[model samples]
Target: MATDDGMRLAYYIVLLVVIGGAMLFELSGRGGKALRQLVLWVVIFAGAAFAAELWMNDGLGGRQTITSEGRIEIPASRDGHFHLTARLNGTDVRFIVDTGASSIALGPADARRIGIDPDDLAYVGSAMTANGQVQTAPVTIDELAIGDIVDRNVRAWVIDGELDGSLLGMSYLRTFARVSFENDLLVLER
Candidate 1:
């Protein structure tokens, strides 16, 4: 996040310099054609500069910005998924926001990461997954936080089967007043 702010400041500084230079040239007896040419070059330079930043910031997407005012904006991953880093039980956990999922699903590895013992959890429940059916165990998250949004005692399931990572499902997402996708951004508002 600090890196993003620094990059933004640098971009603005460059933009200001370019604009100032163009204005100075325009004031120095530049004709309409010269003004037009300056404008075109400025546009091209700005586009290229932004393009370079985007390329450096994960193909122009991913958590490029975050707000403290009950809003979090995340850019789509290269794979086109809205993956976010959330605090689960005070630990940073990566999750893929899955609206189709009924509840937050944690893999065994993730469960352990959050201090839950998978061996002690009883896999009494089951869920129908793309890979047929998988056994699941109920678990409660002490706290889950995404940016300024936080929810306590959140219900989640620990899958006894294989999974790549934890899923942030409707159980947590529905708590938000709004969840939307615009362009390549995922906007979550309280």
Candidate 2:
């Protein structure tokens, strides 16, 4: 989050500079083609600069930019359990990349959203929660995805009773080659 804010600030500063440069170009007295040509070039430069930032965020900017310091406040995707906005069956789902959770756990709502029939599953165990004990049932996510990442027939538990949300426990996090957190960006390398 901090990294994102830093990037926003940096971009804003860049925008201010671009505007100032444009104003200066407009004032540069060379009358006809020369001034118009210079103005066009400036616009092109600004557009390219912003486009590059977007590219970097999309992970297409390459590993060099990911590891580069001060390239963009794109939270260091270093090493940590990150809360990445993941895709699941073409829908967005929030998951906590937790290493502590014994098995993947899903909330009742999430289970329903994923096409699981809550009444059909059997409550097998009592899982401990931050609030207290909760019943857990065996369930499988037909499809689980994150960005371009996807996994099918993933094992997870549907807490029989109330649960705050689902957990992307070690079972899932372990599959990645590397999981890191730096600059507020959860970087996953697989």
TM-score of each: 0.68, 0.55
Error of 1 at 158 (Å): 0.2
Q: What lDDT tens digits, residue by residue, belong to model 2 across residues 1-190?
A: 3465588778868877876777676678556877767776877788787677656454332222232221211233333334445555655666666768878888888778777777888898788888789888887676776534668988888887777667878787777777666655555666
In terms of lDDT, model 1 sits at 0.83
Position 19, candidate 2: lDDT: 65
Q: After superposing candidate 2, which stretches have Cα over 4 Å from the reference?
A: 1-81
Q: Which stretches of candidate 1 lie over 4 Å from their true place?
A: 1-61
Estimate, for each residue in 1-190, the C-alpha lDDT of model 1 and write its tens digit. 5464687878778877777777677667566886668776986788687678666556533463568788888888767788888889988888888888899999889899999999999899999887889999999999987767788898999998888898888888888899998998888888
**Each candidate's root-mean-square deviation in Å?**
8.3, 10.4
